[model samples]
Target: MASTTDVIAAPAPAPAKPPKRPPARKMVAWLDPLTLVKTGIRSAISATIGKQADRRLLDALAAPDVKPCDVSVDAAGRPRQELWLDYVSDLGDGWNSTYAVAETVARPSLTLRDETGATHETRGGAVLVFGGDEVYPDASLLAYEERTLHPWTCALRGQRPPPHLFAVPGNHDWYDGLVSFMRLFCQGRTLSGFETCQRRSYFAAKLPHGWWLIGTDMQLESDVDQPQVSYFQELAKQMGEEDRIILCLAEPAWLVSQVRPKEGRSYLENNLDFLEEQVFGKKVSVFLAGDLHHYRRHANPEGRQKIIAGGGGAFLHPTHLPRKEAELADGFTPRKIFPSPQESQRLCWRNLGLVVSNPRFGVLTGLLYMLLAWALSVNLGGANVPQALGLVVRTALSNPGIVLISTLVILGLMGFADRRFGRWRWLVGLLHGLLHLTAAFLIAWGVSHLMGSLVDLPFRSLGRDMLSAALIFVGGFLAGPTIMGLYLLLSLNVFGAHPNEAFSSLAIPDWKNFIRLHIDKEGHLRIFPIGLRRVPRAWKRGETAREPEWVADPRDKRATPPALIEPPIVL
Candidate 1:
């Protein structure tokens, strides 16, 4: 471990030119057709082919030379040593939300009070660690430059001796098989105002006192590769009995294991367990992660901490779901959760307006209804409403394509159902699919009826059929998404299912948070969990040279400052 003076005395690189102001962008609409298709394809490919490719690449290039970079900063002989570091995750979403966090984190100093009203004035971290998912939707050089790098660059433009930056790859970051992540983070490039110094995706950093921060990259929820495991194993050999380790992972497996034990027993969790038992042993005092986009902390009687602080800038995830207790090691439940359950449940109500929140989703449902109508050849002329409805059900059951579509719908819904529900998920999915199918039939019948009443042409007439199809499309567009929204609301609020879908539909840009850690001279680690209730929605160009190009507009009603989510935890 290098001393503090040794770390800072290193020559500073030439400052890069200030980045141009990033264009204002809206929050990612998860249901939008383009977004859905792009992300879906990338995710599918990454899960299949990308994982294999990464394994081959790592085996070829990294396994033979398993040397973990040493970028540790410590105070070896000093009587008083103090270090501040910041950890944020799931960033690179909308402009307003991302900039809100960047500006706050970039500030030179912050004074905040805990619930006990004890004030602490803290300076910005000398080291900044991005937990995971640096870019949204997908990863690419342009996306990183625009969404990730530009914001921070503009925020830390004029600062001298900029902080050092390190990051772990999340699923989104590995969408391109970590091509973009490697170029941006592992090559030792100067990122905006921060300097990057990691030779690989995973890194081990020695902090002041006897603390070690080790970040791991579990590619696409897979096991830790041999190289990464060996790297950490070597680092563990240097640790003394008194030294403590802060293990950073891409996902909070402990939470997952507790919430959905069967599905959560993944190779990543197994790898972590092995590392704890074999390599790091009891030295790992803290486990930090950020796949779930919220803030939660679970601790045990032995003083080990498991924290999830992914609320950097992405859409808010609900923390209100009823999860099983203590399937994790030592039977630990979350000691702290941000946006109290009441508040989270209240926010879920917004999903009821999914038609308004994600109107594009309605378009997709409408298109599906049209396809089903075409397959069924729905016609209302000279037929009673009951007869038309009966034909829809009969044709839907007989048509191979329609049957397959219905099966897929049910299966998709089943997969979307929370794993915690166990076998009940099948019934939930079937009922949910039946509701949509019934809606489609009714919508088809209504459209045909309207066309028949409005025109004298027969049902087979091209003009009448075309007009009917248009009406069906319009009707489906309005009704399908509305039904989905209602279903999500009921499922989440009543059944405690579809928590991700329910909250994602909201695309909420508030209640962002991050973790700030301080290691005192006595080797005690203090954790301050900071949260922002509402991100600034408005901004103005700065007038002075020293100020960032953009600053939160004082007139914006939603511009609330950062505060302690809970009292600081000293360990």
Candidate 2:
């Protein structure tokens, strides 16, 4: 039988043809000044909107009689003592992969059967708990409709008794002041083809088998609003000390290791501590979060677990293989569950899809500029290729700043290599950096000399000559320093000093996965971190069921990358 990990095996078989996708949307022009201005405006307004939203949610949750949604009990009015919960986060993209995963979860046949082959019907109707970032490219009503709501609606089509849905807004969700999120998940609007009853962005649900679910709201770096704090405090007052909790934070606290925490105390860490100590005053069995766009688990000897399951459907992020786990303030080491190095290399090609426009616009534009320079050099400028190279070298020699910066960059690259490969790391890094620097210098040199030669062109008309010279200078500027600047950016991203984050266009070991949480009768929590080889290009509604494909062996401490298994049930 074939395994899920088979996708990562060496000499992979050719993939079958995939179904066609919708018309491609343009990538966000992140570098545009107007785009930055809009982002700033949205961010400034988001704090106010988020604050008001927190108040409304807190008020509703504290209505003195808000009943918790039940999933552990059956129609017989007895405790089934087991529950399975489907958790997906950062799942806003309505791409083929997102569609496939969502459809798989929407089906009732995708249930868990126990060791004795007894089907726990209570676990079959697994409730959906979305973590955050429900949309991409910015949160708007239209984006929610097309990216999130539509795909989800497709997933739930033809389903019997629909599953209950709950969500907390992410940074993207707050971009539009939570208007769309409020309508889709909080308002009377239906989430699973049935009207949604959830009134608050944050929720507290009582599960069977002695498990409690608490979802919190976080808007950027701000504190969890006073109303939210008060509501949790009130809930804590009524709770018994013996109860355990499954806390769901929209952002992962473990990510602080990759990106440095803010100076002084960490707001996220402090919030969790406050909830655990002041509010709940009890044991939090596990912390589940999204926002990092990957699947990772970190645990200590004490059995407390922190898991990031952001691969619900967003573009994947790289695993932090070279990150020094021991240096993290929280001493737990995170173990990546998906996209082994081989798998990462396989999926890296997907990054090209992200940048290339429908008609290859970006590539074509770059080529056009290059060709214009070539034409100017050949027709007007008297400089030859050797002359261009000599001019660039002379200019580089005159600028000590470039020389100093390039040396530092090379050293950083060496450090990066040393962390990943122990022996002769310095030499490898030096050679790697030198190669990139040489290429960048050549590009700058040739373009600048060509521009310099344009000053000598003999034009028939004075006005035409002046215009041509100005354009030539501008083109030269772009080809010279501007091109070098781009090269430095690329170099830093490709071989920079960071471990957790990758700035390169395509992040490798790009993890695309999610998790399923199961609590047994005894209240013990088990997590399944599942990975997809890639989007099931052929996945469609009403497909026949197959063997359960497990991505990682939860019990194995030293499992190799891209673990696989074929159990009886589909997960």
* Candidate of highest lDDT: 1
Give the CA lDDT, 0 to 100, for residue 149 in model 1.
Answer: 84
lDDT of each: 0.81, 0.57
lDDT tens digits, residues 508-554, model 1?
A: 99999999988877888889899999998878777676777788888
How far residue 224's Cα lies from its native spot in candidate 2, in Å, is: 1.3
Taking all chains together, the TM-score of candidate 1 against the true structure is 0.87
Displacement of residue 375 (Cα, Å) in model 1 is 4.2
Q: Model 2 over residues 1-571: C-alpha lDDT tens digits? A: 8787676548878898543443323233332335547776888787676655544555465454445555567657787677777788987664554654565566565444433444333233456788898877578888777777667666666654566677877888878777777777876465546445566767777787557788888766535776677767766655566777788888876564344334532777788778877888646767888877666677655666777778776766655333344444345665544555444434433433423211222332234334333333333234555675565456546666555656775786576552433365688678766654554444434445555556566645565445544544444333433332343333333543322223223322224565666677677666655555545433223332331221122343332222121121221
> Which runs in model 2 stand beyond 4 Å of their true positions?
1-41, 44-67, 72-78, 110-125, 260-265, 327-331, 341-380, 385-504, 507-511, 538-571
TM values, all candidates: 0.87, 0.67
